[model samples]
Target: MICSHVTVPVMIHLKLHELPAKHVLKRWTRDARDIIPPEYLRYQKDHGPLKYSSR
Candidate 1:
């Protein structure tokens, strides 16, 4: 998972490595799950990068 790669415990708890809350937060957060497929990335390499807001 993305959390495992980060230096700090961003997504999950440090001790248990679980979600801190049961429900989504009401406020908008920059922290979000982003998964880009290899095919699309390769295409972008030859072509230009896509103007995507988020994944």
Candidate 2:
């Protein structure tokens, strides 16, 4: 997805398959808003913010 923010560069070659692992791993090292897809975020709205958790 494209990052409009000045700090983060636009991700041009992103893949959909990559998302599942990131979600399972709960990638704390990266920015959630930047990495995760908007559609997934919208679908998961009931689950609260996509933050890393022990549980």
Candidate 3:
């Protein structure tokens, strides 16, 4: 994750088992886009699937 204009260096990284599901991700995406400005967001790039948790 790279952002030139950042408040916090990062958000806490969640483990794969802790990640949100598709429906929740969809809703969060919608809500975040609604509140967060376009400039702050910038471009997005998926890094492929997360490392799977053995747990």
Task: Indicate which candidate wins on lDDT.
Answer: 2
10 residues in a row with least lDDT, candidate 2:
6-15
Writing each residue's lDDT as its tens digit, candidate 3 over 2-51 gives 34244133334332333335325443664555565655444434335445
Model 2 score (lDDT): 0.48
Cα RMSD (angstroms) for every candidate in the order listed = 12.3, 13.5, 17.7
Clashes of 3: 0
After superposition, which runs of candidate 2 have C-alpha atoms over 4 Å from their true positions?
A: 1-26, 43-55
lDDT, candidate 3, at 48: 50
Better of 2 and 3 by lDDT: 2
lDDT order, best first, reads 2, 1, 3
* Residue-level error in angstroms, candidate 1, position 10: 55
Q: Write down the TM-score for model 1.
A: 0.17
Arrange candidates by TM-score, highest first: which order? 2, 3, 1
For residues 1-55, write the lDDT of model 1, one tens digit per residue: 2334562455444465554454345233434323445555655334575666876
lDDT string for model 2 (1-55, tens) is 3224721332334523333343344455444555777667755544676666798
- Each candidate's number of clashing pairs is 0, 0, 0
